[model samples]
Target: MDTASTNHSPHLHVLHDVLTAATYEASSAMSVWTGGKISLTLDCVREVPLESISEEFDLGMEPLTMVVLTIDGDAGGTMILTFDEENGRGLAASLFKQEVSTDPEWTETEKSALMETGNILGCAYFNAIARLVQAEFVPSPPAFLQDYGPCVLEQALMLQAQCSYDVLICQTTFLKGEEKLNWHILFIPNPKIGDALQSAQ
Candidate 1:
């Protein structure tokens, strides 16, 4: 029997528990903003070789609206919130208290609405992660982009690839009412934060 392998399970379980709570907190905040109960479904949480992304990953063909933000201060890294056409417009309309149809092109007002949603949602998620680790995490002003998913994500992942080949990523999907919203949030934790998570155990 491998005693070391058995002992490692508890630490992994603890970390997963903490992370799950933080993610739920984030989803709750977003639900409030949307004036609806939005649920988040965790798609994947794992560490992957950065190099494999270019060769193996497909971010699908849907047009995406994305927000990219940097985490500064005690912990440094990046966060990205993405929405497909349906979710982006739906959310923007909710924020404006209006109805939005699925439009391939977004208006300036629509863009601003999505940007604001990103700012608020990104901060909520960052705060949760920061609290879990007891570290100060500040988010920079978000940059908005509307493009294909892979293209937009590639730009953000470029920075991570520079520093580490293996990165921790959590992908989640958001749902509004009975309809599933094409919303995704992907987080890349700083190396320092990764060390802190391990040391906390």
Candidate 2:
């Protein structure tokens, strides 16, 4: 295998492990908040190409927001988590219980709840990664976005060009109240980070 492929393999495994742990953490957090069970299906983490999204959802329907959360690494790349609006709202609702509507009118408590939940989920993901890699990683404050398509693509391109590697996409699902929603997390390691992992063996 070439350098790129070789580097991608182990990182993907690391991402997979982190994602699996994150799924369990997210489900546990939701269960605690809602007093309901949360289960993740295997199909959740399977990566889907960007083109396949059209077949996944109805077009011409209300465009859902895709929120991307990225953690910039000291080595030069970033780790990102993206979520569709439906799943985002569902997660927000699951954590907050009230203020589940898609309205901009958010109470102070609702805002705090959303931020707290995002922090918790993001921390769980990175903590698993830190354990697997045996390195300390600190994530910046979480950021939110109300745009998708070109906007998301542009942001991803910026991160990729800076790191010179394609992002590893991990899809996640949160099930609650007879509802199943999907979210995505992208593991974009910096070139140096990739090189370190490749050279480890």
Candidate 3:
């Protein structure tokens, strides 16, 4: 496979359209909630080598909360969305209007909100693709990780290992008020799906 050229797969165009729609939706939602406008930037989407995925984990510490949405295809890979604990808490506090104390009892609520927020954003993106491709796609229930450290990477690695050497990574940034939130969306296509995408071009 020509990895270099595949990096710019046509699927990226579809991905971009979905991201644009999602950004609009995210901005509208945030504006209504915060009384401030929100904007989003599409950072990048590319084919990432497996080794690099491991390196990213080594550089970052966990007790990270990540959400994974799996796509079933011959090219199966995990899509992960990551956020900082402090940022996550801040957003939750702003939305709920309650102090998000570090109490374990309230952890569930915090986790739920995080997952729900991701779902809304993901749906906006995924729904766009579904419309463009004229196919129905369903994302799995989100999986949450509260532990900080290499464990976060472990989960990602486990998910990636089920597929090939390359996975599509989509990076996005959301700005609300003066704060910026980073979102990373991975598209791991199984062998067949990957070949399909590659063949389309």
Candidate 4:
């Protein structure tokens, strides 16, 4: 499992295709689920050293909400859905058909709604992975956290960090009513899966 030290297969194009397709599905699914109320535009998916994730998201010390789901079966890793407190509440309000609140504390109802939203998004990408790789990719029950984005990301990366110092992250920006909402989805691929993806090419 020492993926960091192992020599990776020279199959960049194939790996790129896999990431591209999966991310596209994730964005599309989100759009459909929102009934076009929210539109998602994604930047290119990129792999960077784990330490850089905090800076990549500009995750300062401010508290934010994060939902995590673990991918199992083939290449195992985690997926993170993040939203700042304001946007998180806004999303929850929209889901519940209620007005957005300014309260910083999340009620139980809001937390549940956010977790379900995460599950939907996570399943979209997992479905793409399963279809492309022709292998079972099961997503675990979602876990919710409210903390500094960087702090929450550190927890998400802790297990993956054991096998590799680098991780793959894809960022998607969500727009509502022509205004971009502060929401992001990050995909962290397991090193073994990373190897599989490249070698499959």
Reference-based TM-score of each model? 0.79, 0.65, 0.72, 0.83
**Per-residue accuracy of model 3 over 100-201 as CA lDDT, tens digit each:** 677644477777776776666566666555555455778777776556534555555554466666655555666765576644444433445434434434
| lDDT (C-alpha, whole model) for all candidates | 0.67, 0.51, 0.57, 0.71
lDDT per residue for candidate 2 within 164-201, as digits (tens), equals 43443444544545676555444444445545444433
Instruction: Please list the residue runs of candidate 3 whose C-alpha ends up more than 4 Å from where it truly belongs after superposition.
Output: 1-7, 30-38, 55-59, 74-78, 148-163, 182-201
For residues 1-201, could you state the per-residue lDDT of candidate 1 as single tens digits? 001111133434444555566667767767777776676655555667876764444567866778888886435567778886767777778788887865666788888887777787778667766776787776898888877877766666666677788655666667766666667777666655656666666
Lowest lDDT block of 10, candidate 4: 1-10
Q: What would the per-residue lDDT of candidate 4 be over residues 1-201, giving only the tens digit for each residue?
A: 001111233433455465566656766666676666875655545666877777777877887789999976446667888888888887889888889977757788989988988998788777766665677876899989877787777776776688777766656666776797888877776667666665555
**C-alpha-based local distance difference test score of model 3:** 0.57
The CA root-mean-square deviation of candidate 2, after full C-alpha superposition on the true structure, stands at 5.9
Ten contiguous residues with the weakest lDDT in model 1: 1-10
Best by lDDT: 4
| Worst 10 contiguous positions by lDDT, candidate 3 | 1-10
Choose 1 or 2, whichever is better by lDDT. Answer: 1
lDDT of 1 at 161: 70
Kindly give the number of clashing pairs for every candidate: 0, 0, 12, 0
Better of 1 and 2 by TM-score: 1
Best by TM-score: 4
